[model samples]
Target chain A: MKRNSLHRLLSTCAAMLWASFATAEVTLNIGYLAVEQPRAAVLSNLDPIPDDDGLAGARTALQDNLVTGRFLGHGYEMTEAVVPEGDDPLATAKALLAATRFLVVDAPAEVLVQIADLPEAQGAMIFNTSSGDVALRDNACRANLFHTSPSDAMRTDALAQVLVQKRWTDLVMIAGTRPQDQAYASALRHSLTKFGLRLSAEKEWAFDADMRRSAAQEIPLFTQELGDYDALIVADELHDFGRYVLYNTWQARPVVGSEGLSAVGWSPVIEQWGAAQLQSRFEEMHGREMTSQDYAAWAALRTLGEAVTRTNASDPQTLRSYILSDEFELAGFKGRPLTFRDWNGQMRQPIAIAHPRALVAQAPLEGFLHQNNELDSLGLDRPESKCEAFE
Target chain B: MIRVATACLMFAQPVLADEIWVTNEKDNTVSVISTETLEVVQTYETGERPRGITFSRDFSRAYICASDSNAVQVMDPATGKILHDLPSGADPEQFVLHPDDRHLYIANEDDAITTVVDTETRKVVAQIDVGIEPEGMAVSPDGRIAITTSETTNMAHWIDTETQQLFANTLVDSRPRHAEFVKDGAELWVSSEIGGTITVFDTETQAEKAKFGFEVQGVHPDRVQPVGFEFAEGDTHAFVALGPSNHVAVVNADTYEVEDYILVGRRVWHMAFNRDRTQLFTTNGVSGDVTVIDVAARKAVKSIKVGRFPWGAAFRPTE
Candidate 1:
């Protein structure tokens, strides 16, 4: 009885120590605000992209992380509030703040600014999912929230880095008229100038879904000439009509922009490195493959999860400070480790360029250099952020 | 490798009194030897490079680990065709059937998952990921516990099958190779390849209980040593195959001591026991022979030259 009691005492202490070291369950909340403006709806649906299903790729990824969290002791729950196509986004956000602590808004940049100004949203984390306007990351930045998707300047720079490395010097530029669309057009020109690529010609076309019937203005300059430029760079952010610009370039050059050879956050054909398991797990959960937007959602939620894991606290103050500080480190299927850019909350990650089915190239493409990780080549860093948040 | 392998086949196939199925690599088949007649019975074809073999609890079904095929082939001891099986993921080197008989845990060498397959369903039910490149595994008598040796990580994962969680990752040798739990579920013994020592760990606390290492030169430091082992009941001893030592080391389970060494053929890889643990067999892959040892005397009674390179030795259940 004496020896048995001693053995029993030892076993109990060991079991309790093991249990305490492993049982921490973290639940991350992601709030989504949707829109249904006729013009925005037309632009989003015109490209044969399914509605209610457009964000399926990203939703699947979030769901996968949520499932992994359940068994692995980390949890994530995403709740949504829609700002129907024409409703006032400010009124919609004000009404939804009661239930949501974190917002993943898919709307225009101006509306995102309005959401940031609201007193109720001061302590909440807002993720700008839809807009790629460079202004949000620069002049109009917010201290409490973050951008999951790449900014317009970042996306254009990714392509520029690749075009410069490949020496595709001459390009035919196209444009769309949305407020952010105009920002992308200027960003593309900035890319050419920054990378020393010469622009052959610039053309403008009304944004339309039927690229084949309405792409006449884009076609004549691109398809008929077969002249000076090596590739066509189309900038149709609202409708992404650049896909039709390729093979239609009169000069017979490949196209790059919102279409062919486009650069973005994530793509389906990416299965190298340690990506296989992540890909397999996502497929197992969502019943389909992933898209670029899905990667942004994954990165956003993953960063928050990392912050919680590192700080070992769920308080908003601890998480916000970790993400804003220069001490953050995380690896989320980007082939390289990524960290927050300190000056801004934008996580520096790689940009994979591809068609719907094939990956044409990955940015930070060999020669593009950076003081830190080469992936910083795809986004704006401290020297260029112009983001005076901490300054 | 060719000539020595051919000579190994001379003593392989014939009707025998004692039934011991030996997986021969060169001949690409398993030779059946009858114990009473001390000769061959028949041969059964298995997957390429079949190395591990164990019977179901009832001793009616035999599961063979096909390292090259990356699967476990289950067959009726009387027949050779793959009647049923499940994916071993990749490069399954060895596996142990738990006492429950409901689950068969496999050690797929190239992967980190220790795949657990249900015998009745023949499907991979759960895969508990462990340290890199898990090679050998064993389950305790109660079926509530199991452990796998992770070669690259140089550790052993003590997992709770009921909870399906890796409860512990206990560090061991530079290349912790294989593990076998002693009866009563009180202790688990692990063999190290590089460290050339057997480390005994407490089952509950997983603390290093004791250690055993050989003393002779070249004998003491065996390269890629302690590949696999066989545990016997009456003697409560374990015969450890010392890979480069070309010998088998006898281990006293309770005291954690290497009591003696029995010299055998070159590159000994695995060991097995007879029905009552009175006889023993060691698969010498390089020498291409099976060394039959008399357990009581602790000596090689006879060394039978078997087909090209025998990989497995399994005994028939005593009726």
Candidate 2:
């Protein structure tokens, strides 16, 4: 009778042990915040933004992280808060920062600055997956902020290097009316100066897309102007009139910048360096091609997951120190081991120069030398940076 | 020079394998180079996009994955003639022969299935469903476990050979292209083409033990992609083919440290060692050549021009 009682006790202890192990799974909460900016309804709808925009990318990345994390006995959960138009994003961010240690933000520059100033955000790690402002990368950098999205300087530098390599030094620059377009135009001007390229002609894209139907006949007249340039560089960040300018150009030159042969953080056409696998996985989960925003968000989460796996720790403090250390390197299948810049929290990666069909090349081209890394040639280098956080 | 002396010593040793075969991926042909003469002995036409070629246990027949043809061609190793074709599922990229010399594990990339085929009967015994884009296949030295690296899934799946059931799937890195079991199934190594690292996992614990990265100055870090791995005797040393970096890294398998980087031709994909492990041959895709290396000396000895886009190489024993 005593032996029988002992067997029952042993079985109960085993069951309790299994239950304890099941509940030992660690869960990581990733917070995301983005502002809803409805694109202007234009007549020329070339590449329209999805309803889920940047959130879809984060979702895809969360799915990928979970796949890898499952083997490591880790579980990932993302809490996404999309602020409505004109709503206070900083307020929403504050509430999210209360719960999650890791956050991915797609807010504007001003709102990002506001969120970075919050005392509650001191311990949280924020990944800027949207903004391309060069100021955010330099003067306005935050100790907590990590830019996963390529800066404006990186994008324009990538295009400029490719153009210089192809001997397309003469550029016909066209600027749109949007503020973002003007910012991109300024970055391109700096890139042109850095690469020793000449701006052959400068034109303003005054043609509104809504006027396309009534002013359809005026399209050819607008493009027939004289410009002896090797390529047409268009800064149409609002998706205004770039795609329409492709076949309607006066000269038979290649179109570059935001549309044709453009530089991007991630392109769906990139199949090299095992990007096909990432593309297929995104397609399988979201049933859509991965956009640049999706790739940025995915990269941010992958950085976190890599740190956690390497350190074998889930604590935010431990992960942050490990990530900032020189020992931390995450391979995002970009053909190199991606590391975060110590001067600024920007993740150093190769900018893919691609078209709609295939990858043309990568930035920091051959002969573009840097004392430390070739990727630093794309954006604000150590000496040029004013980010006091790392200093 | 030290490299020249090692080359001379390698030549002085009697060559165990008389011929070496390279699969010309784009040209649909196999280039046979004689070890004694070190020259292309013959060329034979193959099916579309021939890749991942291997010989049978007795070296009588060569099994080549005619990927575009969606079949595995069984060819005469002596003459490089196609004797017959085995029923491999769609898009067979890589395959491995069982140590028992009967079953062949063929990775059907498009189908996401690892088809186990009986070589004698030429029939698929089992189709084990795995992750997407299954590219690499490796059977444990003990013949107990079969591993398939699914590229899109970035996982190395372990399937029990007896049960033919998947037991565990270990995520390595982005776009894992190859899986190799070293140290007699004690260590499992998977190469990530995009991640540019070789992740080693413990076979028993099924835990990632260590990762090795390569660095070649002047070569972009992304181009230092680890692909095929060849082990020397005693599993003490290993050579990893770094794709497009134009280099092969000699790694101390025991310490997991990269000892040396030997420069080779452009886009070196796969390699093969002679029977005595005295020499190594690497197929360079972009340069359209095969680089011969002295294994002991750890240097690229010679480069021989071959067909366009050579993919894989295998050593054939003497007749």
Candidate 3:
């Protein structure tokens, strides 16, 4: 009878030990905020915009983080806040910051800046996954704001590297009137000057007719005035007329930038360096191809997960310092470990030069050397950055 | 009459030298280097984008991971002909033959799973779900534990061989390219390519015991990526292949300190030791050549040109 009682006592002790172990597991909460914008009309119906663009990537990354966290007795949870079109995004951002200090934001540059300047968000770490404005990483940079998306300058620099390698130096550009299109055009001009390329001609698209029916008739005539060039550059960020420009140019030159062979942060054609598995996983989860915004948001949440895994802390201050440190390296499936630049808080990565079908090359190409990092050749280097927040 | 018979027997028994087989990724071919001649004897065609190669226990059959073809092809070594293909999941990058000499654990990069196929039965025994982008595979000496190191997930997943279930998972550095068990299965070592570090774990407790990084003078730290490593005959010393560093690191197994760096060809990926462990051959990817290293001298003796983008190497013995 005494032995039986001892067995029961030992079993009770074991159960309590298990309970204590379970209680020790850490739970981390992250926030995903996206300001919904109206979808732009596309000339081609083959490539439709996905409704769950940025959110799907965050969800997929949450699953990836949980897989690793489960092994370490940690739990990850994400709270999503999508402000509809014409809604007050600031109020939603303020409420999200109140709950979670870590946020992955898919919003415009202006909205992102406003969110970063919030008093409640001072101690928060905000990741910008959508905006590509260069000012976000330069003059208007915020200390807490981190950008995973490639800036306009970075994309144009990538294109310029390929052009220099292929000897397509002389080029002409056709730009739209959209603000993004103008920004990209200016960035392209800057990169061309930096890379010693010549802009033979430039034009602005002013046609309001439907491009689906009149692209072949109107585009060649519109491009005829520019004369012959090595290649044609288009700066239509909205995908409005870029699709119609390809194979419709007057000089029979290759169409690039925003259509045909364009520079991107991520593409479905990227299968090397273990990116195939990521693409397959995203496709299996969403039943569609992964986009650059999806990749940026995925990278943002993964950055937070990696920081949490290393430091075992949930506070934004600790994670922010750790993320910017030299020790942090995130495996971004780009054949390299992605690191954040201390000067601008932009993630350093290789830009994919690809079309819709296949990947042509990656930027920071051969012979383009840098004194510090080869990736610095693609974006605003430390000396060129104007923001003094990091200092 | 007896003297004539003895002479005929002696002529029949010709000495056969061992060979080193290397898979060329871009060329889609296998370059065979003879140990005696230390030169390329012959080259055999393989499936598209071959990366990993290994030999069966008896050394009569060879297996190649035809990555782009999505198949693990078996080859007859004596005739240099492909026999058949095993049912490997999509994009098999690396695989390891179990000590039992039947089960092959293949890391399917696209499917994120470790596929176990029984060579004798020509069937898949189990498909174990692992982390994302599984690139490295290793089996313990006793055939009880198998490890799959996922490059993107940065974790080494331990599988129980008997139950085909994951028993433990341990984190490693970023972009882990290879996993190895040493010290009589007491320690597990994983090399991270981009993180430029090798993490050692205790096999019993699944806890990280030691972590070490590599540095070669005049080579940037970012380029010092640890990929494949081979231990000396007694496991006292180890030679690690540093990818893109153009050098192989000699590490003290006990101290985990890099003792020396032997400059090889450009972009060294993997290495193989001779039957007697006297010579080492490194497959250089960019230079498309193999650097022969003298074991005791710790120097590169010669560079043997091979196919384009030589990736994996395996030693074959012939008695």
Candidate 4:
């Protein structure tokens, strides 16, 4: 009888060992690719940019995914690669892609396209977290590339909707000298035309003087020629002169577009629809306010995490297919389920129209109807994009 | 004498009918509706942005989740006066009373933690870390299991009440706003608001048993967001509040199929059943009204206007 008891104990030990193996944790490795660039000097020093703008959001999302992942016997590890200025970002992206097929990229449109075209990135899913260029979601779209950042068109459309709702039909445009500013200006022009708003006058900002010191004197005179308009649209994408243009405008009208009251992917001012919880969590982690880039990066990583949790697999191909499928819906704290546009791989979400202090409204605003999804009204709809990669 | 006669009439009927307490989120007040008269009898003040409201097992006290205030207020239901505050973690969005009658599981949305407060002692027994933006809270009938559904994490975390630790976590649809343990704790049903689906999990195995979505004939799919749900007396049917769709979906619990959709006011948030489960009162947030549903007829019989942004509803017995 003693020998029989010993055998039973040995069998129980074996069973326990097998059970542990059965429940062994599955670890997923995610890659974060950030391409450093020279940011434009801001006119105001009150709100300085953080060193870890997009990266902090990805880190927080990693922690969030682990909270849900731990209960499912899953673990996640993030690999980061910050490509310095003038360096070949494609090389870093290639290396990271070799290590992990899932990458949250904070890079420009050109670099994003380069990485997506790499042979090594065939099945890999690349999330663009920083680029807002409209062409990336239009003519230059890639099959594997998904954008969390709102396209320039989306932002402009959001602002246009607000203008239409407020009946601010006549607007003047001020285009900056920078390429990004000019791009935004063109997008603003397109949106103004689309929404039936008239551009009363348009002018390019020619002054190279320091806006911080001379904005009050230079802006009024610079904008004096534009004449009277309901609102002044400034396309200073780098925040260079937007702050100064807000109050110093020639006319006592609302200043919008890239400053004053602007359309954003996410903002700290947004507190409704359970966004306060997200903002608090982010502030607790990184002692600063969450910005638009941070929100984009967070959404990118969370998208992968959601797909992984649902599909029960970490393979890039499986996650990509699942993320693109009808089953995938990301609760982005925007009071709506953010879904990717099938034609362009752009995340369809409500853009918040706000100033620095308070949220004015969220677009796809009421009465801005669409034949399909209301969010589709803000960006490149299915019929607007030229890229056929998703097909 | 008129007051004396009314007092005598009240004394004649010692056991008054039930009262439906609805929390107005924007108004920061609780409107007490007389079930007998189907009207608001009294409105009591509450803390800022009260989202969740519940009563103790014996109906002696009520707990309100004052989300903006970040504290759970305990009130005397008899007098509608605040008695004390429970040490709820920051941003208590929703909470459930454990079957033991003394423990309250509060889902702190800001902290991503579940704060269990002992009502009698007014002390936090345990603060269990949960997923991000935890909003939904529910406890099993036997008090063995508790569920916290995190809105952002999109997962229903199953907690072991005895140890106060997460034993299992199951993935639900996007933005799970509410969870309920039904059929004597045999199954747990979670409603995903943004995903527009209800996921039911088998408690024994912690496996997803069934998942279903709602559809109204003319409503857009995006508007059909399932938020809060309540099961009928026998647990045979479920009434799910579909946010913004302005309809409540009646589902056959056993079959996991939507039997019908009863159109109500705009942005229906939550519902509470009157005594005997014959009538259900739903709080409509946008319309600032309550749609009363006759359970047997499966139709909305009345719409009573309430305060602005009515969010949560609870039935209080007057006897």
- DockQ scores of all models, one per candidate: 0.03, 0.28, 0.49, 0.62
Model 4 misplaced regions, further than 4 Å = A1-24, A210-213, B1-17, B294-308
Which scores better on DockQ, 2 or 3? 3
> What ranges in model 2 sit over 4 Å off?
A1-24, A46-48, A86-95, A118-120, A208-226, B1-51, B59-95, B104-137, B145-217, B220-223, B232-237, B251-260, B275-278, B294-309
Ranking by DockQ: 4, 3, 2, 1
Query: How does each model score on TM-score?
Result: 0.58, 0.81, 0.86, 0.89
Candidate 2, pairs of clashing residues? A57-A294, A335-B222, A336-B222
lDDT of 1 at B212: 72
Candidate 1 per-residue lDDT over residues B82-165, each given as its tens digit: 687667777676688888887888877655678888888778888887755576688887888889886544568888999878
Task: Please give, for residues A1-391, the per-residue lDDT of candidate 2 as tens digits.
Answer: 2222111111101112223222426667788787666567554665657776677878766665554555456667777777766566777787788877888888888888889889989878999999999998898999889998999999999889999899998788778878899999999999999889979788887765455454335545665674567898989887777777787777787889987889999989987655766776678777888988888888898788777656667777888888888777665757776888888888898999998988899987887878778998998888888998866
True contacts kept of each: 0.00, 0.32, 0.58, 0.77
For each candidate in turn, give its C-alpha RMSD to the true structure in angstroms: 14.9, 9.3, 9.0, 8.5
- Give lDDT tens digits, candidate 1, residues A1-391: 1222111111101112123234535556555566545655432344544353324544644544442233235555555555555456776676666555677666777888889779988888777766677777787788765787787777888898878877888777777666656788888887777778878877676645555555545576545654677777777765545555656666656778877778877777875423544565566556666656656766666666556545655566778777777556555555444566667667777777777777777776766766666666665677877778745
Write the number of the candidate with greater DockQ, choosing between 1 and 2: 2
Model 1: CA > 4 A from native: A1-28, A40-46, A53-62, A68-75, A206-226, A274-289, A325-327, B1-115, B118-158, B162-319
lDDT digits (tens) for residues A148-182 of candidate 3: 99999999999999999999988999999888899
Give chain B TM-scores in order. 0.89, 0.94, 0.95, 0.96
